[model samples]
Target: MSDSSTVLKYTPAEMMIVVAARALAGVRTVFVGVGLPNIACNVARYTVAPDLELIYESGVYGAQPARQPLSIGDPTLVTGAISVTSMADLFGLYLQGGLVETALLGGAQIDRYGNLNTTVIGNYDNPKVRLPGSGGACEIAINAQRVFIIMHLKKRAFVEQLDFLTTPGHFHGGTSAQELGIASKGPQLMITDKALFDFENAEREMQLISLYPGVTLDDVVVEIGWQVRVAETLSETAPPTTDEIALVRGRLSSGKQSGGTGEA
Candidate 1:
């Protein structure tokens, strides 16, 4: 039995974190990018996926950080890690070697095809806002067995086409990833604050699979830049249960809030 009378008082950012964490329920090993992805991985570890191994790009593997690390290079990640290897080994042996089961990533821009752009906001030559260029995200996006992208549902962020393709999704749509010889399956899900999406369609376009509580199709449509497709069996995403909320809040209570860079 679960507590049914628990009050639902949470922010959209918190909801995103809880939802993203839930997506990692049974994942064994996750190559975690910084920001929201990092928080989600730790939340999942404290709640549903206790044995979840976290691998950081800075070469920390199976990291059980006492507190949320500021970045991948933050020494706290290496505190209780299983093995602190070199960047070359981590990428060559684990990520590209196909040992990583999943990778959680965030992007500045995402298209209907799930292609991500974290390079720049505007023109590459004369950029509007230069973002943190893809640091291991390109490799993780193409090499991880499965990739989960987390971002907020905003009109600007969810564009029809990216200003730049920093990380490949279903490149130009279709079997292009396969044709390009990408060994790992890409862009499994795109978790957002308002809705949950999956690239289950034959075209590999992002399809709205579930909507968060109180959010409607119109709301999602208004936020996305393109004419987003809806799932045939569209469903409402389950609200966070009492236990799930507690675990997430507890894990994030160490003065580290959930919101991160560029909606991800």
Candidate 2:
């Protein structure tokens, strides 16, 4: 097929979703947040990976939405979803009870220790800015079989220690997280706009495995604003395939044409 005639090409954002979705290729259920993870899950369900199941923090499982949901409480999230359960039951029974295979999250501040701070930036009692308080993140992190973090990494957001322990990453370091009363498995992958990182043997530190195309290791280091470790051998991220790109563009175009869900 001619390059122009063939369909499906993913954009950088969609490519990021594709990379995130790749991890869900064989996952049976995913406990997800509402933003990028939501779109990524839908993309996975419709495209490359069909086995990926979505579970909302609101306790909706098997949520099969024709379009992306705006939030955990979006009607489509409840209506199109296969089953809706109580929030407590979803966490206590499904999550903490060991039913979820993966949980995806995003946070404002992530430390080298892998700890997340989504609560506040300044003081706890009287803070400078009171961000949305941590939701079921602590439970999700503690209960899920595995975890995935999708965020645009920057120095300020990636800190030395999160101001507040919104979600446990690693209590200390090197199996200390497990020893520190944390029950769930540590993060499996940390996907950023610049590169992808894998935790170093249960340690809170990340080792660079791959860098996105047109992104250099030095470029990543500069943007990180911290002393992040990169492996001696790093690979370049493969650009999105023509088919993947086309599919994403088609979805975007379709959304625009249909007066799509106006959720950013």
Candidate 3:
């Protein structure tokens, strides 16, 4: 799947889920967020991480959903769960207690330091769009061992500064979470339709690590609000294989592109 023509066979949304699913190759437990993240975890369970334990916000731990769940509260997640606890116990014992290995999250906007905004799109007091505000995402970002975020590349979505900081990515800068005495390693990976990124730098900025098979440097740069940094040894992401595409499509009923930058 190295050829751009081959990658074009699948929509960018399918590519994102395939890549996101592959990212959990060795991950054991994942705090699965809604939508794309949920589908990705299920794909991982069938592919890369067969023993992957999915933890949902609605108190279902070690979930084995038969089909793609509509939301965190979807009944499918609870049917085969290892254990279902109270929301308070789930958050306090697993997330905040530092048992979660990784979390897959999504947001409307993300800045250089990886700060997220899922609140008001404009001014909080007077907003243009009132998005679904943070519901456990704030705690997930701060408490999960690390986070993997998924979003399509877009100018306003990848902003210079978030309208309202909902989750702590890297915070002020590198090791800032440690400076603030937070134990979670914060965001380790971010998957986009056009590229993959990591914060493995002195400043912990969202550094581009690889481009999708058909995407180019200019393609990624034009979508971000700030001067995006590319990895010194950048490479193309492996395009989705036939089996991987089948699995992704099987999990995502619509196979639609992820929501674009949340009205940004």
TM-score of each: 0.92, 0.87, 0.91
Off by over 4 Å in 1: 1-7, 255-264
Q: Write the per-residue lDDT of candidate 2 for residues 1-264, one digit (tens) a residue.
A: 124434353445666776786667777888998767876665565554666668888878877655556778877676456679999888878888888998888898887767788999888899877889788888898788888888886777877767788988766768887887777777878888778887766466767889887777787777664687877678987776665454455563243222222211
Clashing pairs in 2: 8-242, 8-243, 8-246, 8-247, 9-244, 9-245, 9-246, 9-247, 10-244, 10-245
Sort all candidates by lDDT, best to worst: 1, 3, 2
Kindly give the number of clashing pairs for every candidate.
0, 10, 0
Better of 1 and 3 by TM-score: 1
Candidate 2: residue 216 lDDT (0-100): 78
- Candidate 1 yields a Cα-based lDDT of 0.84
Q: Cα lDDT of model 2 overall?
A: 0.73
Error of 3 at 76 (Å): 1.3
- What is model 1's C-alpha RMSD? 4.5
Worst 10 residues of 3 by lDDT: 255-264
Number of colliding residue pairs in model 2: 10
What is the lDDT, from 0 to 100, of the residue 99 in candidate 3? 91
> Higher-lDDT candidate among 1 and 2?
1
Judging by TM-score against the true structure, name the best candidate.
1
